[model samples]
Target: MIDGWYWKFIGVGLIIYSMIVGMLVPLKPSIELVAPSAAKTGQQINLEVTGYNTNYSGSASIRAWLKDEEGNAVLSKNVTVINAQNLVANFDIPGFLPSSDRVVPFTLILDHPVDGAMVSPDAVFITQDSISKVEGQTLWQKDIINDLTLNTAFTFPSMSLIRETIRNTFYHVPLWFAMVIIFGAAVYWSIKYLRNPQSYQYDNRAVGFTSVGILFGILGTVTGALWARFVWGSYWSWDIKQIVTAVALLIYMAYFILRNAIEDDDRKGRVAAVYNIFAFVALIPLIFVVPRMMDSLHPGNGGNPGLGANDLDNSMRMIFYPAIIGWIIIGLWLANVRYRLLDIKYNLMNK
Candidate 1:
């Protein structure tokens, strides 16, 4: 049999390692925000650009462009580097955008040999000037967007909207993953106690795991709240998923309340087991099923790519998978400690 401490050591070591790496790994250069999003054609638009993980003043060969969906681009006449994370690019809007619509969105592209290429989609909109005669070729100045350098550096993706908060994936998501596994393990013990109703030890294990699982759920809630404050602009938006998750946790909290209210050992074990099974039954629909059927602010909801899709690329996957495994192990370790303590209490009480 494997030594108990060996597994515990592995759990602690993996968590420490993954946490260090996840926090330390830098994000690739990306545009965080652009001001004055609209400009009329046949005018010069000075864009105030904000960047993440970008070095603006470091390189002299910084180039900028405003590209349309149809592969057409307008080059910036001058790029003024304000600092490391700020810059201003001046674009002379063409007389007419090559589009059917009166207003067209343009993606802002910045290229530096050191920072490589960073793009912010739909950063600015260009509206056609119907009063002026449409002359695209002459207004564009024949400048081409070419020879852009590629970012070969090893860094996490810095996407717009989410930006730096992407780092929360390592903690927020894996906490839920670990919480589910911990609760599932508790359910297993609950089922075992149900099969052999006389065994108080099985009840001990179930309660212990459930206790830590609730703690994990609370932590997940806090982290998720913090993340929401950043991305969704509110700590609690009363999103359907958030509401369901809160309800699920409250149901689990009652498991302990029921156990505490009971006087007899045998009665508590039987009641908690049956309740736990029902609670688990309720958990699935509350967290996963109900949220999908309704509107939710979370990713992968409302026809967006999931956690494993465009958001999490290869680099994130490397840390993300390890973080999941590490967190699961740590949660199990905590559950084991909890059950052992309960075992001690039970032994003392019996004696």
Candidate 2:
């Protein structure tokens, strides 16, 4: 038994080793924001920007457009940058004229000079007033408008430690993946217990995996909390992602409570299994469905998908995948140990 457990430990170690090596590989891709932001009514705004190129030289230019709340184009021009190296562009919008309505929007464009190099994100113009007055004079041209053209070379931010930190992606995403797998196992054992009261192993499996899943779930939650606090600020906010995770944890807790409420070992397993299955069903909407529909502070919502093109770069993916596999294997090893202990304690008590 000792040798077998040692081999299992070695296997888990190897999986972790693979994850570390996998995350070290590098990848490069072009990433840029389409625009700075949307506009509202009653506000004057300036666009600002920065760019980075790792390999070669790159230049960027800005274009500006003014639109109504409905996005109908009102006026457009190319900004003349006073200083390209400074990378700043300023534009002025005249106050609402008799014909001009409320809530103006602005869009900025960033163009690149070189083929291989990518331009940084474009800036956006949003106004305070969303409502527009319909009966306004359409002007051929406005005198108050000033377009600024700026030239700026692209620059890359320091990403060496960040590149290696991509392993956290695996750490963040896959422990839940393994948790999903183990929770599924828990449900399976629950169903087996309900059908056959004589089969004690099924009950043992249900408890065993649920415990392991909770342990890893907590780890994933803590790691994610740290990551969010660093990148987003605040350790806990009722963000959709965080809220859903809390719900998932609560549902599992109810499962454990239901188990303890029952006195018969046989009955405890059977009832707990039933609750475990329901918890899995509840997990789907809490973790995946509801968060996607709402405006999330996290990336991947409001027309932005988190970790898509901009957030999790290719360099980060290398380490993340391996960390997931290693953690899941380790989770299973712990589950086995728990399952065997339960089996032994039951046998001795019955004898």
Alpha-carbon lDDT, every model:
0.84, 0.59
lDDT of 2 at 91: 42
Q: Could you tell me every candidate's TM-score relative to the true structure?
A: 0.90, 0.61
lDDT of 2 by residue, 33-103 (tens): 33346543333444444433222133434344443333343333334443323244344444343234343
Clashing pairs in 1: none
For residues 177-274, write the lDDT of model 1, one tens digit per residue: 88888899899999999999877888888988898889989999999999999898999999886898899999999999998999998898999999
Off by over 4 Å in 1: 1-3, 131-145, 303-308
Top of the candidates by TM-score: 1
lDDT of 2: 0.59
Model 2, position 351, has a per-residue lDDT of 98
Candidate 2 vs. truth: CA RMSD? 8.5
Off by over 4 Å in 2: 1-15, 22-118, 123-166, 302-319
